[model samples]
Target: MDTNNFEETIKPFFWVAHKSSFSVCLNAGSYKPEIFETREDEGFEGNGYDWGSLARVFLDERKPHLAEYVRFDPEAGMFCAYSSNPESLKEFIVDFKKACEDDAVINDLFSRAELD
Candidate 1:
């Protein structure tokens, strides 16, 4: 993998951590988890920072092969995974989407990443 080139292609996203849940915005896009007030049941006691770390570990273990491209920014609650091979990236995204649907924590982070 071309580390320098891969780093150059990384896209940064923004997210907002709420008391329990969080929201993400992509490329100046609208904030997701928009109906925050109504999602009280989805809220957790932990903060976004903690969730970010959890997300990092989850993805690392869940898709060990993609470890090289997966990165997590706990401070911003942002996650990025990039690869020169579009097919590989697409495969990872598909697996990740399945994971998100199955795991709540991953779902939260994935939703915030705005990957879909």
Candidate 2:
């Protein structure tokens, strides 16, 4: 992998801890998208940062390997693997970032940068 290029891609954005208002996992590869509660119920333990992996599914298809978000309160970028393969999450983060950029509500949420 081109570690430097990957690092470069991630570097421009500010890392912030994200609390996903809505989250789920899905078996979209199947006939229809189905939620995976097993992953959801795990809650905070679901992923180190507790990000919803399924959200990646909604991300830009151009980046098919959507992965993890770099949370700021947690305040550092840490790599975590996808469920089946280890590559999905990076693209997910990129897509998510784009979504936030394109949508105001999402961008607003991150703008406050303080949670109660």
Candidate 3:
């Protein structure tokens, strides 16, 4: 949330990383119909973003409470990161910001691969 940070500064790097990993999902052939054919199949949606999606991706399993990547410890509500290595999580946040800032970068990254 650094207002001074510009997307252009991080977009190129974000695109590279996103493409390398997400290209697989884009090309999964059956992914779209199987997972996205209907709104219901798409899990949760809001503002064109899946707010809790990252938690689901990280946990990859059902749990009673939402899996919080950044969590509050129950004993004292102390903040803790539940899932990834701290550096990786930081990089991901940066990448997300970059993607959001540059629509062209986001477009190209997704266009490079097909969801179906």
How accurate locally, in lDDT, is each candidate?
0.42, 0.33, 0.31
RMSD in Å for candidate 1, one decimal? Answer: 11.1
Best by TM-score: 1
Comparing 1 and 3 by lDDT, which wins?
Answer: 1
- Candidates in order, TM-scores: namely 0.38, 0.28, 0.29
Model 1, residue 116: distance off in Å is: 22
lDDT of 2: 0.33
Candidate 3 lDDT score at position 61: 32
Clashing pairs in 3: none
Minimum summed lDDT over a 10-residue window in model 2 is located at 70-79
Candidate 3, position 113, lDDT: 24
lDDT of 2 by residue, 38-112 (tens): 233433222223223323234323344342332112211222323332234454545554553455534333332
Clashes (N, CA, C under 3 Å) per candidate: 0, 16, 0
After superposition on all C-alphas, the RMSD of every candidate to the true structure, in Å, is 11.1, 14.5, 14.3
Better of 1 and 3 by TM-score: 1
Off by over 4 Å in 2: 1-4, 12-84, 103-116
- lDDT, candidate 3, at 105: 49
